[model samples]
Target: MTRTPQCPGCGREDRLQAVPAVYLGGRDTVRVRVRNPDDHHDRTVDRPVTTALSEALAPVPEPPSRAIGCLGVLALLVAVGTFAAGAGAGHWLDDVPVVEGGGVFDENGIFHAPGQELPTAGPAWPDFAWLAVISALALTAAVLVLVLRIRSRRAFTRLTSGRAQAERLWSRAWYCHRCGTVHFRDAPGEDTRPLTFQEFRERVWQEGGYGDLAATQRALGGVLSIRPGQ
Candidate 1:
């Protein structure tokens, strides 16, 4: 039979508990009085343990959402509509005759010769075509942004999965209540020095493939950084 590892601080193996079990056993319930005088019943609130031990053993936070929102889709749609409208307008305007000089039509529909006044309107096809090009560019940009956001979201999901696996590895750790430290049975080396809660958690993250994710997050400006309790 394999012998359990001894605690580094106390040189004993008796007062040990699994990290998950410790967290579960640390929970407490409290009664909260209602504010309204008419409501005499007190409400019971179940609160998780917030002690240093519990904090060290807490599960990894959920990944941040990076998917494009509804507003973004709406803007993309608007750009497409604008592009279509501009293209159609430009096509129709291309066939229209340009007004070169001021003229008037007689009551019998006969064209009158140019007067002293000059034509105020210029050809509109160029402006409409320019509008179409601008809207097309905007639509392209919106699509690129949406794709990037989706990729970012997928990366975050992978990171979250890695953290969860790390948490599972952490569950195998044993906390020594007597020495206020934690140790892993299968950890390498026989030095047996007790690790603080922070040290243990950090070790778990680093060794469980979570370090790579964290480095990537830092490189990407921390967009995948863990959020507060939510």
Candidate 2:
């Protein structure tokens, strides 16, 4: 026979329920009436207790790989634009004839050439070549950013592998409605002071190895620490 769960705070077995069960039981549904049957809707409402439990048990969000990837993509677009501009300028410059002094005069009468002796006021072939080189460097940087993003995503996946075990631990937690405290079923009898929701959740996650994972992520730095709200 299964023994009834007793609340550590009130020493009563009558009002104790599993945390997950309490959360589920505290939810209410409201049906909205509409003229059309297809437009009818049912909305789930969570009681205050249920909302608190849900927030406490919510999963840690993944690292901001998507935002980093967007930066990589923006860099790639800039590289492409610069490359196209450089190539177009080079092609246009190739058609222009060099004057007798190895320099060409622009419509504004500014002279440009490959050497230091000539005036460098107008666009020239060498300028476009340097632009192409800069574009190539930018492209390389963008590629590196994208690769790092992929690696960070993979690392986050590996780090969160123990989340299921943490959730299992959470499922076994008990809530005392009378005193508003939570505790695990196997909690020590001597340490019967019930934990707050946050404390309970943290203990569960720590026992499930998620605490180390969080620490490791923090050590890794960069986008790993980029969680929402902080």
lDDT of 1 by residue, 1-230 (tens): 97777776788778877888886675565555454456765655554334445545554532555345554576588788877788687663444444346777655666756643333356555767767776777777688878777777787676666666677667768877777777776645422467665566566666555664333333221112222121
Superposed by TM-score, candidate 2 places the C-alpha of residue 208 at a distance from the truth, in angstroms, of 2.9
Given candidate 2, what's the lDDT at residue 148?
A: 94
For this target, which candidate reaches the highest lDDT against the unseen true structure?
2
Query: Over 4 Å off in model 2, which ranges?
Result: 1-55, 59-61, 92-124, 174-181, 186-193, 213-230
User: Per-residue lDDT of 120-200 in model 2, one digit per residue for the tens?
Assistant: 355566767877877888899899998998888887777677778777776777866666677777644324467765566
Tell me the spans in candidate 1 whose CA falls farther than 4 Å from its real position: 1-4, 28-31, 36-49, 59-157, 188-192, 211-230
lDDT of each: 0.61, 0.63
For model 1, what is the alpha-carbon lDDT of residue 92? 39
